[model samples]
Target chain A: MVKQKSLRTLVAAATAALLLPASANAETVKIGVVMTFSGGAANFGKQIGQGMELFMQEHPEAFGGHTVELIKRDAKHPGGDVAKAAVRELITREKVDMLAGFVFSPNAIASAELVTQGKVPMVVMNAGTAWITKLSPYIARVSFTMWQSGHPMGTYAKETLGCETAAVGYTDYPPGKDSLNAFQTGFEAAGGKVVDAIPMGGPREVPDFTPFFQRVKDAAPDCLYVFVPSGNHAGAVTKTFADLGMRDAGIQLIGPGDITQDTELQGMGDDAVGLVTMHHYSADYDTPQNQAFVSAWKAAYGADSTPDFMAVAGWDGMAAIAHVVKTLDGEIDADAAMEALAGWTFESPRGPIMIDPETRDIVHDEHVHEVVKDGDRLKIKVIDSIAQVKDPCKALKIGKCGE
Target chain B: MADATRARERATAHVVTAHRWRWVEAAPWLVATGAFFLLPDYMTLGTQIVITVMFALSLDLILGFAGIITLGHAAYFGVGAYACGMLSAHLGWTEPVSALFAATLVAAFVGWLSGLVLMRYHGLTLLMLTLSVAILLQQLANTYSDFTGGFDGLTGIYFDPVFGVFEYDLWSHTHYWYALAWLAVVFVVARRIVYSPFGRSLVGIRENALRMHAVGAPVFRRQVAVYTVSAGIAGLSGALFAQANTFVTLDVLGFTRSGIIMIILILGGTGRLYGAFVGAIVYMVLEDELSKLTPEFWEFGVGLALVLVVLFARNGILGLLDRARSLLAERGR
Candidate 1:
């Protein structure tokens, strides 16, 4: 049995050798992108890939004549096992210079130890857990954290929306918990009382929010803040709220922009109208940079597939990588790359953004937008903007984020 | 008297051959030793393969030798992982060896309890019962998020160096050896069990339970015993995974995992001791390569490979090799 297996192994190794790419050029920078490229969340990977491609195409000189090679791997699901294995292979065999693109927080959290051990600088594109940066010193986020939007939304809910009492419904996970804590802290600090905080369900599937919504309706708070993940869960929460007629009861529906994601907005119909959210980027932003980005995205991916915050994060993440590549002159070192990324600021399609040196997390503008009906389609109308919002979980030294 | 003496002589020879360590049996160990020195970059994958082989070996004990088709084998694996993870993360029991033992014990106790109920059923009903047990555990783990970490996974698990000498290096050289050592020890014990009189009795029961019962072999008791042992070994594999990865997730108890291991066992050929080794290496390597070639739909490649195995090598890769070897010998003659 062993001898036959060994023979088969030799055959396989020979085949792999034949398929192996030729030796890398001196200026080539390989970035291994690990994301959910298959399964239900495949769109996250697609959007992020498009964003990276767009940035590279638009800024040809960004890498300073170095050829950028992206080796993409499918994480498949929110479960971290596949992602962990993919990262290991990328680091060990492929010997990728940098790592980017994790759609799920669990996947990012799982790869933290590997990146630290491998001494690879990881640019997180879209995992929102606040404490992820604290896991590895070689990590930095181009994406926004839960606390960045959730904390400000909490204050906005009380002072701007004039909601004296509120209820928060969050998907039960790490990011969910972080979102809940951030919102509650901000709300209470702004003199608003939290009537109820319910963990709806896990983030693996689109959970039915009927029961949770009914519970919130019973409490009858002035406003309801929810934080589910940004894909199908958001649609379910919107449908549930509409079905339950909570808005008719004069209870304001509010959350982070996950509920009003651009790609999901039109499908939500007018039911999404009057739903207010605080978030980083929106495809409908009227700014010149954002309009240009939206047009380029529509041109590339088709008019129907709107780019969401994940895409923006992917774009900004690539920009950060490009910045590192340029500053280091294509000689990528983990410590040097991280140093170049620290306090790096750029005018993004989302407006001005920076990597906070202290926490190694993104600092960006948080826009409070209301979903409004524009002709036959729903649109995001920015009502308020809070510039340069840092992750409050880190800023306030809350829980594990302080460590 | 002459016929009986001849039979006794043949039986003694069989026992001697089973007891003796064949030169061919040492080949895989030598290959593993070579991989440690030569394939330094692949040590992490090597460790994973070793861990998987251990898990598959445990499955072979009951599913192959005892004919107990369990779909929820991951229940024991998940139990072991969580037990080990909680030990190190919550209780600060960072010692790898003792923690593994404790985790294995918990999984065995759980298995023994479940085996009592499982021994009463067979076929589809038995499969469903096992599946339900795994699903129940998964739900319980998810609901009690404060303890298990729920879907986000349990982190902060750190292990001390093995025997306080070899640290788990970034290259995973130490991890490969540590897991390989455990696998070697378990393989020997498993080989012994499968070749013993009790092991023959399991094959007897698998072939015909009624006949074994008529012969007064206490079928149910033997089945339960093998299951408990299998579950313990599986738990040990899971503990190794948790310790090596230093993180535990709900995927440990996932349905996909249980299915994947069953497929691996069938692909290597059941009722063979070394089948686990061949199956795990093939499946894992195939997955690694296929995913790289086509990241979006890599399962398509894996599915194609499995279909070919089922159609051509019905008894699996080992059975195919055996047939080819015999054919060559016949031609030589």
Candidate 2:
């Protein structure tokens, strides 16, 4: 009788061990992440990943009753159909409750489709194509869209700087086209004229940009507006612009959000000093939340690793997801989480983010900043803030933005 | 008795000849084609297999049958993709027509121009030249964004129905069938070419280029013609890809795109049409599965699998299956 009882107890213990959740061993909410880990866009993805990691480390087990597990996949450069295919695998096969981290617009767009199809809530950190908010109900962007930054930059150029004519040069993809289009709309609305718009395709790894610079020079606009993402490409473009002595041509270089975030522009030295851009969450933003985020991020990643806009966005996105998951006891039901997110207001490092239920777009403030030399490091000084800018997709009647 | 023995020997010789012909003939290819089309129910998987098979057939003409090694095949693929995208976006040409025009003209033009450089070199030099061409095209596409739409790509594109039938939708089921049909046609065409005199010359060159040149085979011309044809087919695949997805990004020109296609070819077993199909299907399925397991660490598994195949199986999975069948036959005997 004693032997039988002991055997029964051992069997019961084994059964319990087998049935225990995998998280009981590690105890983290597994997040399947796809990003440009091994490509030209890798820097942006790395920054975002770092930011998310920082947040997770700081608030371990903050989401309900589970710890968070972040699994990253590198979507190599020029991923094309492969990236979309990867997203499908991440969502359907991985069964991740939530999807996040795509720095490039195309990757985000593709992943957004899968997220909607899988009925999973996605908080897109970076890759502001405007299509994410417009196309899918499943997608909630924490990052500013191209137009969100471009429109304000245009407004600043006209209202603050008193610029009359501007020459626009941007890569000719969805993000670039969207940014340029928004700049045109806002600049023209403010009674400013764009002299010449030159669209350059991106991922530029060339030695010479003499021809592109010459064209911009010939346009003879008072200010030059260029949007080139990726640090290597920015370095090349800035170098070429400096080499051609375009600054003396009376063309003050103005860029969209990407310009200030790029570390490579620091190499442009004095040439990048007077450059102005419109973005959210510059490192110089003076707030307790911002300072804490910056200090933690720097401590974790290192002092040399300055956080980009995408990092801030990613940190906020993780926080938002955590907030919803905590509310739902770590069971991320799509409808419940989305309802929780709609009209959801959160205090982030970038002040307050109010999710507009009508547009499903994060209606927030944009800041116009100028590059200033803060000792040896380059920092953005926020000169003005453009508040409550409406969703551009709603205005353009493109995709399903109104829904 | 002697007469009977002679007759028996003749019968044996005839049987041997028939068996040899069967070994070298069309039965294996026919079986492979049937199996390739029949497998894979998922639209994405099916479409990927079809596209990759088409890409392999294009390479087979140059590398397998002909004596050419190209590391820059993605150049023509990108050109076709960009051309088709630009045409459909600007002119709003129907999908099939635009795809056909783009694949044939743009791919052929780029092929011919690049051929001038490619033909000047052989072996490693030719490989390097092709790589440079592909990289240059990718840069040009990125640097001149006004046309190519840059890194974000030309999105929100809609394609008209295929010949007024079979609408291309985002779900990609119809596109899969369309691509499969195209693959069948290209396979048949490739088979026909492989049996032709031109194909004989190509084989001769691949076997011994110096001897073929001595025999006045016009080796350079043959190489150029095969390269152009291969480029055209690759272009066709790229155009189909763009049309099917309704999106074309600059990544089509990236070196990794070219490398992945090459890897698919190697995984499927080079020099065989069915190899590409089988390889693409298996690679995609594995990727789909592994990514679910561990999104970051899946590549390690894939890399390990590739290494194992390279070390243990010389002829890939298909070859291993063939070996297994022969071993079974020996056991039965």
Candidate 3:
């Protein structure tokens, strides 16, 4: 009897030890982030990482007394098989509680599928592919879809700029197509005609756009819409356009946030002047939240931190995750965390951001801005704000968007 | 005199004898293929394997049977992919037929064009020329945003069913079967070519180009022809890939893609037709598993494995299996 009692006591002790640690660790949520931290997209990833780090530094605790841990994997820029492999690794090996941060749509789609199949909650940071919100409930995005800015940009081009005919040129990819499609739909709806739509490969190909520019110039469109994303590509094209004296020929250049935030555009000096773009946030948003973020970012990264739009996206993503965790009292259950995130609203650097209950995409404002020289530095000046744009997926009836 | 006669006869027999074919020689490969294909179907690994097999078979024509080495195989692959993507998006052609014609013609044309430059060079020069072609193509794809659909990629491409019978769905299972069938066809064609007189002459050139030239072999023309054919096969694989994923990106033409395909061939033991298939499947599976264990550091493991394979098993997994089989056979004897 004595020996049996002692054995039972030992078993009880072992069970307690295991259970206690497991329970304790349960409160420590592990989130996997896959982003292109190396190669071409490295700058975007670094900005995201920095934003998350800043959020973590401020909040310390994620939420609800839970500790947040991040497992980072580099989705190499110019991503292909390596990015796919990284996503599989994050899901199967690390077994993260949540997955997020695919900057590109291909990587986003690949990672989203793996995470959704694993039944993990995923939040996209910078990728704007409409398919993410439309296809899966497991995904929520803090940034605009590829089409989001296009609608506002189109409206502004017609109503604000009073442009009658707009010629569109973009890369021949999903995001480019989606953006142009959205712009066309919105531009046409606003009684503006899209004179021409030209598709190019991504920034890798340094295309001689003399023919394209000549065609657009010959068409004599009131506004020229361009959507080249990469810095080098954007700069080269801007220079080429400037060199051809297209600006002087009365063709106004307009595009998305990528154009305004591109370092290459800044380097273009006088070429970027008077170019209009649609974006969610600019470095000069004039909000306390934005001011604090800019201050923190500048302090952390140095004074020459030419903040890209991705920096704001990264900041918003981290803040949203932090807010949800804090509201839940540090509990890390996927369903509960998702529920908490649904109704959550937070002041982001880009004004007020709230998770749309139906689509799970963040509902925010899109701004139309003109590139203006502010004291020696060129900055985007907001001319108009398209407030409270809902998730486009809501209209498609694909998900429970806007719930 | 009798002993000398016996020695001469032995030497003559050795020269005349061809390599023996055995069921045992194929048993391990058969088992491996069965395991890789059948087992992976249950896990959805078969789709990737099937695509990779097609990629390898395409390379086999140029690298295995022919003495040509290309570092820009993915250029043709990307061209095929883009052609299919463009045709499907613009023409709204059905999947299989479009894939058949687009992949073949585009890849053949690119290969033929490249062959002019590639055929002029040999050794590392050919490799560099192929690399330049790939880079140039990638650059063109990126620069001409009006056609190639830049970084955002061509989206929402819907492929109609094959002959209105088999539907092209998003589920990767259908893709597995389609790719597998194509791979089989490519394999049969490759096998026939490798065993034919043309194949023997190519091998002869590989062994002694000077001797083959003296014997009046049009070596450069043959090399170019084989390279073009190989490119068509590679293009076919790319078409299937574009169809399967319903998307095509610039990454398809990237140099790293060509490098990975070459690695697969080397890992499986090049110069053997079946080695490409085996190597591709094994490399993908290892990559899948390794990435699951440690996402960030999996490349380190892959690098280590490559080093070990190079140092100890020079002939690759197939060579190791052959050695093991020989050892067991000797013991049995």
Candidate 4:
């Protein structure tokens, strides 16, 4: 009987010893990534994923002593319903510590309530709608708003390009309206007048720009400012602009960088050359940090794939998340994570960036880039730089931003 | 005298059996109620599933029973969502029930007007027209960004307590129950309509519209009536969704939504009254679980399941059960 008791005691001691390691090291942080992984905008997810992965590999110390696990769910589309459902499941079922990767404004907006209710910090990677950060205190953005680029482009067009008047043609949606407002306000503030503003169909399909451009041509604005959601729309606009011979007609092609998105720029060929626009990041940025990032991206992905602004946003978003994780020491309280991100500054490939404490939006340099053809490839060359440009919509207390 | 009395008794017994509530019918509702206790963490998903079930049931009323093949039933759903959403956001109609009713009426009226053109055509032409209607509405919403929010989605929507009692909670407990109650009421009404003579005539029209017309059944009028009713029910479901989510996107009118409901009905076995309930539950659960298991490739699993169901269980899961039950009875005999 004594021998049997001794054996049982030994077994019990061994079981406790096995369980101690599991219980002692329990600082695992699960981040739920909700992004459109399928459909026309699927490249957004692929680029964002590449950026995040590169950041994680390069900056392992960003996570401190925590074991970080990524739980990715496909938003599928930008309708908001699918995104909301995915977010609800991630919070309620998976119980993720943080959330990130929203590529569309509507998807991010629909998830505001869920993140607020779940007490999880959400880092917006690519959704650039200005008021999204204000929707929930738990939300923070690394992506630049439309106003961030549009407003600066407007000022550049008037002061540098010597365009006295501009006409705006944008996809009829919230982001499009935001871009229109941004450019118009900046141009008018800089003593330039907006002659005409046309709402060109919706964003779901690429509408023919013949009639709209003809109307603008008739109005004869000194410069034409256009905004369409990036990808094929940018290619279409460039083709239409060239086809209509607007440049030869003395109306300069100028808008935000969305018109010459890096992914679609090569397809536009010579038509996109000499087009001047202001934006945050370009693949052709000649900074050492950007060079390293671009090389790393090429090494990681492929030589054929180009990292655009969306990719940079994703990389910076992960950097912010890592900072929060390190600061909180893996005991990631929702409020503390948000506190760590507010007013946080980091040197990104795009240049130095800071989260504005007042508005919870991104603040970075807006570079005026001129598309130039070099060796049969289109490249954006930085001509002028507007340093530390804040989101003018929030800074100026615009309509919805005020509330 | 004895023979006459026996025939009358037989007819009465048959009527009673037709109207009787089977124990099996109650099982699904019981399981749904049980989910409230068992799935506290899944209330949001529960609310979504219940709302989807209601929407699928509405589609079944037309496509399943009336045999009206529509590719844009989401048109009515979108109208309902926009009406309810705009009413609350703009017109200050905060009461959920009243707003739902108003939205239903608006959807039904739109359905009636469209039915004039839609009901006259059949096959691919009808399908194309329905798809166009949905696309046109989506564009209209997109064009009018000020009112519909235009792809950014409708915001600032607020709902008063349901029946001035139950408030929509963070856990979505109220949303689930509210949707369930509406589902129950709609289910009962739909059940009655399906078993009635009007419902039988719809089936007859589906089987052979020429024969139904030869019998003086007024095929076009019946199609229009049933389509309007289905649209109203679909609108109610959409209103419930808008109130529960407190937001609406152009997706409400997208082709994807219309296709999803049709797929649910097909998977659950169309023309079967309880098919919507089963199909919705299975599809929702599978989608939820598969997405969790494999986020990137979950659609492949769902597609595989659909192909299998179509190949083996041609009538759906219910049909498979029916065939099994008959085989067992034959063996017993």
Candidate 5:
């Protein structure tokens, strides 16, 4: 009877040992990454992934003794249902601590419900629509929003660039619409007249931008302030502007950060030279931190592979995660991480980046830059700056903003 | 003795048919109901699969049984989604029952109108005509950003509750059952439609429309009716999608969406009612699983498998099962 009792006790002890590992295995902080790593917007995800890798390699101690585990799932750019499915899988299946990465607003909106419902702290890496921040309480953005950079460009174009009458054109999509509307709001608010707002094709359609450019030329404004998102549109836009001879015609062309992205500069060459645009980060930032980041990036990915603002935003996302680990003593708590990120201010390569307490969006400097030839490579030269831009959507009189 | 012999033969034949068909028919639904309890953790993905199956079923009704090819079935889907989205978001129609009916009617109405033009063409012309309508609607949605919420998509929309009892949540526990019930209802109605004298006529038209016309079948009118009915089902699927996802983007109306559904239908083997469910389950689950397994996952394995299915199992996965059943029966005899 004593031997039987000992055998029963051994069985019970063995069962407990098997179950304890699962509960006690909380030493690793896992970030579920749902990004458009495939499909049309692959570049953004690729760059962002690289940026996170660079940060994780350099700052092992920031995790507060826990190993950072990243479980990535592809949202497929512009994928709606897939994004939701990914978030569900991440939260329930993999049991990830936090979530990050999205480039398009549509995908962000789709995943927002799961993020909100699960109470998972999702650090928005690049999706910049103003409405995205309002979706969930647990969401925090480490990237610049369309409203942040676009609204200030309106002011810059009118007050600094001295644009009296401007004709507007934008890529006909959600992000493009937000960027243009914010720019127009800021421009029109500052006593500058918008002659015509010409809409062009989206990613699905290959449209001739020449006609839209011709329409802008006919309007004959002081400058044509347009919103063109990155991808083939930016390349087509720079070529169209050059082909239409708008620069030679003495009508200046300007836009938001998407048009003058560092990646797009490769195709723009001389055409992009003197083309002014507004953005959160310039590759040519002269700060010591930025210099280190650039050097590290160059060392990791040759001299030709440069970093974009989206990549910097991804690095900042990891920085936010690091702060969460530091603040909570390496424990991954959703509520604590969200609370820490809501109004957290940290040193970024771009500068001192602060998340707005009210909106939970990145409140950082918006720089007005002109594309210039720096040696063999073309890069944006920061000419002017807008200090601490908050979300323009929160200040609106109406609209739910998807909340 | 002669009458008794004939009766005995009929009974034996009926039993064999029941064994092959009825049990086979109930298996998928029974397995799905059984899986509901087991797959609690994957309810969201499961719900999405159920919705896609419902969508594929609608396409099978037209493209598979009726022999009509369409590239823009998403038109009805978008219409239904927008109808639900606009009503719930803007007009304050919160009742799920009312919204579903409204979405169905709106989709059917649009389907009827487009059918008038679409039925006049054949082959590529018909395909292009169908595609054009969807594209036009998408462009209109883009142009009137104020109403449809433009490219930002119509946000701030959500379902009230299922029968004012169960509130839809992120876990999709209630949604799975709610959608399953709808699927069962639609499946029954579709089965009746496809098996009826009218369904036989539609199949006959698919085989040879000219011959069907000569046999006093009103080809165009019958085609229009079936298409409209199919559209209503697709709309219901779309309305459920809006309810499930709680948001509507222009995605429902895109050519890619239409193309994917078509691929699902073809992959599952067209003409069979059960094909849609199998196709959706296999496609969606594989897509969800494959995408997670690797970074380079692009449904390439799915594409390769589809090519193999078309080359080998001409009818679909169901066809392979049908062939196996017949072979087993032959051996048993």
Candidate 6:
């Protein structure tokens, strides 16, 4: 059995070696996508990759008279070394014009070195690390940082929703830590007091959230804030809170929108209803810009659709770059691309957003949403808007973009 | 008495033949050195291969020679990586050589303590124990994010120039040569240990623990010692990797890493130290390159190759090479 498996593996590998597509032609515009297609955060990169592919399909002439090709390279492991090598290979061997698609912040941080060394204009799609954009002159971000997404919720909770005392619960990891801190910083800045701040330490595959929710319930604050990741497991956080009967007690559930992720809230039934959260995108955030994107994406993928934050991120990224390419008329200029992208405003599915070239982060309207149980299904309803919120690093007294 | 004499005579003849071709043992190191000079452009890839080669070599000692089956050998690997990483980033221990050495000893001590409990079990329970220990270590590292960097990984950790003379450069050839030299040293030590009387007794224990213990082999103590040695080598490999990349993540101590290294050992053939060299090169290069083509389904290719190697080449690539060498000699004759 082992020997058979071995030969089959070798033959397949040999076939891949044979099918090595020739490197990027000098004439065409090549966008090297260095990302993790296989790992813990694979979906983050995959959605971005798909979004670009979809954009390329919609506008065949994306780069103004040039044949554009997206060469995707898996970072395999996000241990910095792999990302560096992948980016190097793309720049030197593939001769790609630009680079995009970084989901893991560590991978982005690592690839940042290569972007500086190789001098490739790298467009970051979705890595929320605060200092990622500060890596290189050639680097720019098309996605919101964790702080940008979470801080608005804190401000909204305090001033808009009239919540004075709140409880914050989050996983004990980097993104989780960053989200919790961003919320606390923004909440405290807005004159709100945190009654209880709890972190769920250890790994993600916890069988029970009963004990964690019990602690939050015990605090009995005006609002309960949670920070869980987005994906299949996101819905379970709300389901757990619902099962614990926290919502029935009238301590309104508010979280970093990942807990009620677009793709997941539908399957969560009524468990996530009235769950208020904030993120970069809410597909139900009715706008002419959103309608076109939601309709087009739904038309392609099917009607039962909710644009994942990752997918929206991917769509916005491609759209921003395409706008740059159109202005430049087939040439990829690093300075010009950065200049054009800086004040470049585009209608994203979320709403209108402009690229902040100084910080290289998106300046977008943060959607304050409510997960209303629409009959038998759950969907996000845009209840309020946080207008033109800049990157929340400015909220930090000493954070990356802060004074 | 006559049959025993005949068996002894065959063993003596076998030893003589192996000694006559002993220079072949230097083949991997010599080839790697040549590649280091010839393939300057591929130093990064070479560095990764050398690290993985060293990692699989350590596994070869325990599972191959000493017959200790483990599913979480990466626990030691992760320990060594984080130990070196934290030492470099937090404590300013920038000298790669001494930091790696100290980290190896730490990993060995951990292995010794764990071996005390693990040596009592034999099969699935033993597997579960090692796996749980690995998971525990990973969680502890993750939970204490302040120290471990918690998922963002241990970044900004770098090694000083070799002897403070050879500057760390763009191509990372310094890292490649350093790793390659350490690999040579580790391989030699492993060779010396495995060829000793203690190694033969380890094999005896593996074949039948009851008989070896009854014969006063101190089976449990021997197993623990070999486990510690193997763990030290794994830790060294991890330290080298951490130093070369200047970054370490929880993934280093992950379950998948343990599984991959085991497969590399098996695919190269067990009980053969040199097999690690052969298996890692084929596996790592195939993974690094082919993954560029089909990012999503490349593992399918890796899985298929492993299954084939196991089914047909039971002794692995080394065994296949041996058969080819003998076949070439026969054809020449």
| Comparison by TM-score, 1 against 5, better one | 5
Candidate 3 chain B: worst 10 consecutive residues by lDDT? B36-45
lDDT of 1 by residue, A1-403 (tens): 1223211111111122234442243376888989887767888887887798788777756766566778878888777777887898899888999999999888999999999999999999998888899999999999988898889999999999999999999987777788889999999999999999999877777877999999999999999999887757887888889999999888999998877888888877667788899999899999999999999888887877788898999889999998998888788999999999999999899999999997889999999999988898888999999989999998899877887
Top DockQ model: 4
Candidate 1 lDDT for residue B155:
92
lDDT of 3 by residue, A275-316 (tens): 788878788877898888888888877987756668777778
Q: What lDDT tens digits, residue by residue, belong to model 3 across residues B1-333? A: 999999999987864553334465465347545754666433245566777778888887788767688898999989988888778776776566656676679898889888977898989988998999998998788777457654546544567776677864323456566777777778778776776778778888778888989999998888888888888888888887777656666788888899989888888887787678678878887766654444444566778888888898788777787889999999999
Give per-residue CA lDDT, model 5, range A1-403, as digits (tens): 1223211111111233244442343355778888886666777888898788788766655655555677878888474767777888789877888998887777788888788778789899988878787888888899977787778888888998999989888778877777778888899999999889887877565578899999888878988877776656777777888999887777888998778777667776576778888888867898998989988999987888888898898889988887886677667777888788778887788888898887788888888888888788787788888777777766763245534
Supply every candidate's count of residue pairs whose N, Cα or C atoms clash at under 3 angstroms: 0, 9, 39, 0, 0, 21
For model 4, give the RMSD to the true fold.
Answer: 6.8
Q: What Cα-based lDDT does every candidate model obtain? A: 0.88, 0.72, 0.73, 0.87, 0.81, 0.79
At residue B271, candidate 1 shows an lDDT of 89
Give the alpha carbon lDDT tens digit for every residue of A242-280 in model 2: 888888888788878676664554665665677778877
Cα RMSD to the true fold for all candidates: 6.0, 8.1, 8.7, 6.8, 7.1, 5.7
TM-score of chain B of each: 0.96, 0.85, 0.88, 0.95, 0.92, 0.94
Off by over 4 Å in 5: A1-26, A395-403, B1-21, B323-333
DockQ of each: 0.31, 0.24, 0.17, 0.44, 0.42, 0.31
lDDT winner = 1
TM-score of each: 0.91, 0.76, 0.72, 0.92, 0.91, 0.90
Candidate 2 overall Cα lDDT vs. reference? 0.72
Each predicted model: what fraction of the native A–B Cα contacts (within 8 Å) does it retain? Answer: 0.44, 0.26, 0.13, 0.47, 0.50, 0.41
Clashing pairs in 4: none
User: Which residue runs of candidate 2 sit more than 4 Å off their true CA positions?
Assistant: A1-31, A60-62, A66-71, A172-174, A199-201, A206-220, A235-251, A262-270, A327-331, A396-403, B1-50, B75-151, B154-192, B207-229, B239-246, B263-333
Tens digits of per-residue lDDT for model 4 on B1-333? 999999999998986687668888998789989999998879888988998888999999998988899899999999999999999999989999999999999999989889888999999999999999998998899878789987889988888999899977767899898889999999999999988889989999999999998899999999999999899999999999899878899989999999989999888988887889889989989987776655556677789999999999998888888999999999999
